[model samples]
Target chain A: MSTKTILCIEDDRFIGEMYIRSLKKAGYEIDWVVDGNDGLVAARNKSYDVILLDIMLPERHGTEILEALRGGKEDLIPKSYVIVLTNFQQDDQSRIAMEKYADAYLIKAEITPKKLISIIEKIQD
Target chain B: MEIKKGPQIASQFWPEFIKQKIVLIIVSQIIISIAVGCLIILSGFLAIGSIGFWLILGGFFVINLATELLIVISATRPTKDLLAAIINVSGEKSTLTPPNPNTKEYEKTGFRDALQKIYELSSVKDKQKTDESEKKDDNQELSIIEALNTTICGFITLDKNRQVIYANKPAPIHTNVDGIKIIDLLFNGNDTLDSWLDSCEEHSVHDEHVWTRIPDRLPNEEGRRFFDVIASYQKGSTAETVLTLIDRTKSYIVDEENLDFISFAAHELRGPITVIRGYLDVLGDELADVLVDDQSELFHRLVVSSNRLSGYIDNILNTSRYDRRHLKMNLAEDKISTIYDTISDDMKLRAGAQNRILNVDLPTKLPTVAADRASIGQVFGNLIDNAIKYSRDGGSVNVTAKQNGNFVDVSVTDNGIGMPESVVSQLFQKFYRSHRSRESVAGTGIGLYISKAIVESNGGTISVRSEDGKGSVFTVSLPIYSTVADKLLASNNSNVGLISEGNGWIKNHSMYRS
Candidate 1:
C-alpha cells in the first residue's frame, strides 16, 4: 500500500511530536503508542515495516518491551524491524539492547526527527 | 699549689693551705744559698763573736719566706694572664677571677686526670673526646662566624649605629652582599625597610628577635620563595638578624592539580548528561498516550533516574561557573510567599509521582526579600528535590518562612532519613556527601553548600540540623532587601544524588499523559 508501515513507540511528548511530524512527511504509514502495553497490542494486531522505540517509558521500558518482542516468547507481532531511541550513550546499554535484537541505537542529541526518519527508511530499503 | 677559687670563693683569699712541706722545701733551698752568702759575713762575725752563725740563720729564714710568697703568686699567674688576654682579645667582660685574688690546687692531679674529668662532663666517646669536643665547638663557632660574615638568607646584625655586625651563609648566596645593616637586609631594595628600621630603633626596646618571611619572585618566574629572618638584642649587646629560606613550588603544584581534576570532572560529566536529559524530554512527548496502560513500578524508577541525572548535570554546570567566580545570578525583589507558591504547585506534580506531600507554612503578610530570585528559586527547588529523593514513600515535607527583625527566615523540614553527624557538620561543604546519600540518592552534594552561599551572599545565614533516623531541618535567613548576590558560595557538588521510589511522577505526569 504505502511505501512502508512504521510503528513508533516513545514516551516523551516533544520528541514524539517531532518524530510524528517528520515521519509523516517522509511518506510512511505510521501507528503510534505511548504506553508499552499499547505497543504490544498495536504490534500484535497489525504488521509494520519497522518500529521506533524509546528506552524509558511510563508503561514498560523500551528495553524490556524490546526484549520480550525479540525473545520469541509470544510472537505477538511479526518480527519486521526494531530501532531504539534513547538519550543514554553508554556502550554497555547499547550492547545489551542490540543483543536483544534492537536493529539500531541512535543518540537523541546527535539525531533529529528528520535524520532518524531517513535512517529508518534506509534500513527498510 | 692551693686549690682554685671556683668551688670555694672565700677560700681563694685565705693563704692557710700553702702546706708545710712546700714551705720547708723553699726554706731549705733558701738556707743552702743564703747561708753561703752569709758565710763571708759569718766569718767576720765569728772572729768577733758567736753572733755570726745566728745572723746567717735569720737571713736564710727571711729569704725562704720571701721565696715562698713569690712562688704562691707565680702559681696563680697563668689564670690571671689568660683572663687579661681574653679581655684584651674579646673586648667583652664577664664574672672572672681577678688577678688580685687567684688560687689553684696544682698538686691535686696530672693532665690525664684533668682530661678524664672533662670527658665525664662531655657526652661523647672517650677516645680523643677532648679533641672531638674542641672540634665540635670550633665547627659551631665557624658556622656562626660564616653566618655572621656572609649574607645567608640576606641576614645581618647591627649595633645601635645600624652598622654591619653579622650575616649568615645564605645571606651572600641570596643577596650577593656582605657587611650590611639589619635594615638593609630586610629592605635591601625596598624603601620601607628604611622607615621600618627607623621606627623600630626609635620606639622598640628589648630587641626580641622579630622574624618575618620576605617573599621575592625572580623576573619572568611565576612563583616566589619565602625567606624567614629574625633579629634579637641582648641587654648590653648589638642586635642580630637570622634568616632562613623556604621554596613553595610543590604546594603550588598541588593546588594546580586539584583545579585540573575539578575542571576535568566537570566537563566530562555534563557532555553526556545533557544529551541524556534531552532524550528524556523527547520521550515525554512520545509516550504520553501509551504510558497509562502499564503503570508498573519499573516506569517510576526510569522517570526518577532521568530527573536525578538532570539534577546531576546541573550540579556539574554550577561547579564550572563557581570555579570561574563568574557565576550568573538574577537579583530581584520577590516575596517569600510567591516563591513558596511556585514551588508548591510545580513541585507537587513532581512529588505526586512518588506519593509525597509538601506542607507550606507561609505568613500572609510576608516580607519582601531583596536577592537573586532565580538562584533563590533554585535553592529551595533543590531542597525540595532532595526532600522527595531522601524521604521514604508517603513522607511529608514542611516549609515555613517568617519575618523576624528585618529578615525573613525560611526552614525546610523533612521527615526523611537523617544524615550522619559528620555529614551534617559539612552539609554546606562543596562535593562532600553522606554515605547514606551515596547509596540512596542521586545528587550533587553541592545543594546545601550552594544554598548556604546563596543565603549568605544576600546578607543571610543558612544552617542544617539533623539526627540519624529522626529527620533534617535546613534553615535559611535572608535580609529584607537591598543586597546583590544571594549565595555566599558557588558550590560544585556533582557526586550527590537521591534514590527513586517505585511509584514516581516520572511515569505519571501530564507531559507523559495521552
Candidate 2:
C-alpha cells in the first residue's frame, strides 16, 4: 500500500503539534499549517489524503478556504477528504463546513488524537 | 406634559352652510311671486274689456310684485342675523342675539327659525360623537397611568420648565426621594440640571445609575439605595422630559449568585475533563501496540464514558447560557440532510449500545433551512440521545425527516415507557424529569430544556406527541431558507386562491401520524 499523507490546518500550536506527532507515530506522513491563508496555499499546492482544517484561524477563516477549495475556479488540487477539527461548538460553523463539502466534523476537545486517527483510517478504508 | 385644549367647533359647518340653504328659499319665493303676478294679469285680461281691463290687470300685478319685494327685503337682514346666531350655537362663532320676534322680520323669519333648529340638532349629534371619543381616550390614559403607578418600575415626567408634571408611586419606591427636582435627583443637589436638560434634548440617556443617601429612609436605614435611571426628552409642542427608574438591588444579588456558581462549575469541570482526556490520549498512544484484546476493549469503553461526561458538562454550560439568555445564533443557509448525515452514525452507535434499534429515514433532497449547524446538531443529538436512554429495552427508535410546507420537519420516535400527561407537559422545563425516568435513567434533567432553547432561538419549534404505555414522537420544525425571488413571490400571494392553497399546505403538512 502507498504511504498516506495528511495536511493539518490548525491555529493553536499545542493541538497542531500533538496531532502531527501522533499521526507521524501512527506511520503516516503529516504536514501542518498554522494559519488559514497558509493552509489554503498548501492545500492548493499539494495533494493529500485528508485535510484537518480548524475554524478559528488568524489570516482567514478555515471555512472560507474550504469554500474556495471546493467551489473555486482555480484547479489547484485533486479531490480529497476535508475534515473540520475545531474547538468552536456553534451549530452554524459545523453546518457551514458540511455545506462546503466537508467529509467530517470533529470537536478536538471531545475526542482523543488517537481516536481521531482511527476515524480517519476508517474513512480512508 | 398634557396640554389643555378648549372645546372646538366643527368649523366645516359655518355661516356659509346656512347661507346656501337660505339663498335657495329666497330664489324659489321670488320665482313663485313672479308666477302669481302673471296669473293675476291674465285673469283681469280675461274678465274685462280692452283699455280698462288692461289698466286693472296692471294695478293688480303691481300690488302683487310690491308685496313680494317687501317680504324679500325684510327677510334678508333677519335671515343673515339668524344664520350667525345658529353658527354661534354650534360654537363656530361668538354669541349673537336672534332677530326680534315682534318685528316685521318675524313674519319672514320662519325659514330662518327652521334652519336654526336643524343646526341645533346637528350640533348636538356632533357633540355626542366628540364626547364619546374623548371619554374613550381619557379612560385609556387613566388606566395606563394606574398600571404604571402600581408596577415595580418608577416613572417621572417633567415639563419643559423642568418642573415635575407627574410621578407614579413606584418613582418614590425606587428612588426613595420624590417631589424633588429631576436635576437634583440626578445630580444629587450639585445644581447641573440645566446642562443635563440641555444635553438630553440632543440624545436620549440610558442605564444611568443613581445612588441616593437617605439617612432616615426608614428606622435605622442609612445605606444608599441604588436605582437605574433612564431619561429621554420628548419633543413636541410642549417639550417634556421622561425618566424611568428601576430598583436593581435584589436582581443584582440573584445574578451574582448565579454567575458565581456557573463560573465555578465550568472552570472546575472543564479543567479536569481536559486533563483527563489528555492523559487518556497519552495512554492510548503509548500502549496501542502493547495492549491485550480485553485491555483494548476496556480502553475504548473508558473513552466512551469520558466523552459522555464531557458532553454533560457542555450541556450544563449551555443550560447556564440559556438561563442568561445569551445563546447567540450564527445563522446560515444549510441543508437539513447534512445534519442527518453527520449524526446518523452516532445515533446508530448510541442506540445499539443500549440494545435498541435505530432507523433513519432521511429524504434524498430537502429544502435548505436557515439554521446554525452546531446548534441544530446539538438539538438532534439531545433528542436522539433521549430516545436511546428512554427506550433501552430492545425498543426501536425511528428517525425521519421530510419537507413540510416551508419547513423541514424532523422527528425522533421512541417506543419506550411513555410519560403521563402531567410529566409530558413539563418535559421541556429546566431541571424537570419524570419520576419513572429519574428512577430508571440517570440524567441532569436540563438536556431537553437546553435543546428547546437552542431550537427556539434559531426560529424553530419542538413538540412531542405521546401516550401512556405507548411511544413518544418528538418533532422539530425548522423554516426553510428562501432565495430573494422566492421570498418576493411568497409575499406577493395576495390572491385568495393562492392564500387558501398555502393554508391547505400548512394544514396538511402540520398533521402528525402516530
Candidate 3:
C-alpha cells in the first residue's frame, strides 16, 4: 500500500500547522491551505484521497467549494471523500444542504489532531 | 364655609317659596282687605244727613264684610288644596292628582301648572347631576384609551359577536377594523385567532400568541411584520374579548441580527480554542514520558478547562437556538448506554479534576428511548457538569438508568450541597441561580434550562429532588421507542416530522420523520 494524500483547508494558522505536523507524523502526504480561495484552487488542481474543509474563510466559503466539486451528477474529484470541519453552527437549511455533499461533518472544537488522524485512517480503509 | 352655607341655604329657600301658589293668594288677600277698609271709612266720613249717612255706612260695612269673608273662603280653600298636593308630591306619597274638572278656578289660578313645573324642575335637576358624573367617568375612560393609542401596543375591543366595538389609532393602522369581525382583519385569520379567542372565552382568562409575517393581504415597504398578540375575555363587560397587539417586528429583526452575530462570534472564539486544545493535546502526547506527577496533572487540568470552555460555547449556541425556536431535534431509537458511553470519559475527567468520584450504572437490559443522541448526550453532560461543580471535593456523583413502564428513567445523583425546595422550584428557569451559588459559582445559568428544553422536545420529562443540607438527585424519563413506535409511524405515514402530541415547538422536516 502507498501513503495516502490529504488536503486540509483551514483558516487559522495554528490549526493548519497542527494538521500538517500531525498528518505528516502519521506518514500521510498532506497539503494545507489557509483560506477558502486558495484551498479551492488547490483542490481543483490535484486530486487527494481525502479533503478536510472548513466552513467560514476569507474570500469564499467551504459550502461553495463543496458545491463546485460535487454538486453535479458526476463529482469533479471523483474518489476524494469530503469532510466538513467547522466551529460555526449552521442553520437547518444550510446544514441539510452541506450534509448531502459532505461525507462527514465534525465540530472543530470537539476533534483533536489524534482523532482527526483516526477519522482519516478510517475513511482510507 | 359657614358663611357660604348660609347663602346657599337662602338661595335655595327663596326659589322654593316663590314657586308655591300660597304667596300669590296671600298678596291678593292683602289687596282686597285694604280696599274694603278704605270704602267703609269714606262712607262714614261723608254724612250729609245723620240717618242716611248711618244707613250708607251700615250697608257699606255689611257689603265689605261679606265680600271680605267670601274672598277669604275662596282664597284659603284653593291655597289649602294646593299645599296638600305639594306636600303629597314632595313626600313621595303618590303621584299628583289633577284638580277637580268642575272647579275651573284651579286652572284659572295657574296653581296646578306651577306645582307641576316645580316638581318637574327638581326631578330634572337630580337626573342631571347623575348624568354629569357618569359623563365624567366616560371621559376618563376615553382619555385612557386615547393615551394607549400613542404607544406601540395596539388595543382593540371586540363584542360578544366578534365585532370590532372599539379600536385605538394603532389598532386600525393595518386594516379598516371598524364594524368588521376581528378575525376577518388578518389574512390567516380563522385558524389561529379564532381558536385563541375560543380558548380565552372558554377559560375566561388572559392568553397570548404570536403571529409572524402576517396579513398577506397588504404587503408594505417594511417587508414582514411580527405581532405579539395578547387577548382577554371579560364576562358581562362591553368588550367581551380584548385584544392587544405589540408590533415586535423591530425587535424580531434585532434578534435575528443578534443571532447572526452570535454565530459569527462563536466561530471566531472557537477557532482559537480549537487551536489551543489541539496544541495542548499534542504537547501532552509528546511530553508524556518527560512530564512528572504535578506537571502531568497540570497538563490534564489545562485540557479539562479547554473542554469546559467548549461546553460553554455549545450551551450559548443551544440557548440562542432555543430562544429563536429554531432548535430542530432529530429523535429516533437511541440507547441510553450508548449515550453514556460517549460522555462518560469527559464526565469522569471533570469529576476527577475536582477530586470527586463519578460512577455510571446502566441496567443490562435497558430499553431504547426516543431521543436525539447528540442532544441527549448534551443533557447528560450538563447534569454531570452540575453535579461535579456543586459537590464537595471528595464527594461522589452517580448516574443510573433503568426501564420504568413504557419509559426509561435516568437519574444523576450528587453527594454535594443540596438546594432548598424554593430554589429547586426555580432551578430549570432560564438564568435562575440560587443567590449563594451565583456569588460563588461561575455559570451562565442556562444549562439546566437548555437541558430541560431538549429533554421535553424529545417527549421526555426532567425533574430534580433536593434536600437543603443533604444532597440532590435529577431524573429524566424518556418514552420507550417501541411503545411510541406506532404513533411515530402513524405520524410518518401522515408525512409530518413528529406528532406534536402537545409539544408545539417542533418543526416539520421530512428527513427527520424516521
Best by DockQ: 3
**DockQ of each two-chain model:** 0.02, 0.10, 0.21
Rate residue B207 of model 2 by lDDT: 20
What lDDT is obtained when candidate 1 is compared to the true structure? 0.58
Q: Rank the candidates by DockQ, best first.
A: 3, 2, 1
Among these predictions, the greatest TM-score belongs to 3
Global lDDT of each model? Answer: 0.58, 0.65, 0.73
Q: Say which prediction, candidate 2 or candidate 3, comes out ahead on DockQ.
A: 3
What candidate 1 gets wrong by more than 4 Å, as runs, is A1-125, B1-289, B294-304, B340-346, B419-422, B435-444, B482-514
Distance from true location, Cα of B279 in model 1, Å:
6.2
lDDT of 3 by residue, A34-70 (tens): 8888998999999999899998888899999999888
Displacement of the residue B339 alpha carbon in candidate 1, Å: 3.3
lDDT per residue (tens digit) for residues B419-511 in model 2: 778888789865678888878789868788778877777667889988888878999988787732365345433221110110010111112
For model 1, how does the per-residue alpha-carbon lDDT over B105-128 read when each residue is reduced to its tens digit?
323433334333433433344447
Query: How close to the true structure is residue B51 of candidate 1, measured as C-alpha lDDT?
Result: 72
The CAPRI-style docking tier of model 3 reads incorrect
Model 3 Cα shift for residue B103 (angstroms):
44
Once superposed on the true structure, which residue ranges of model 3 sit more than 4 Å away at CA? B1-144, B147-263, B486-514
The DockQ score of candidate 2 comes to 0.10
Docking class of 2: incorrect
lDDT of 3 at B56: 61
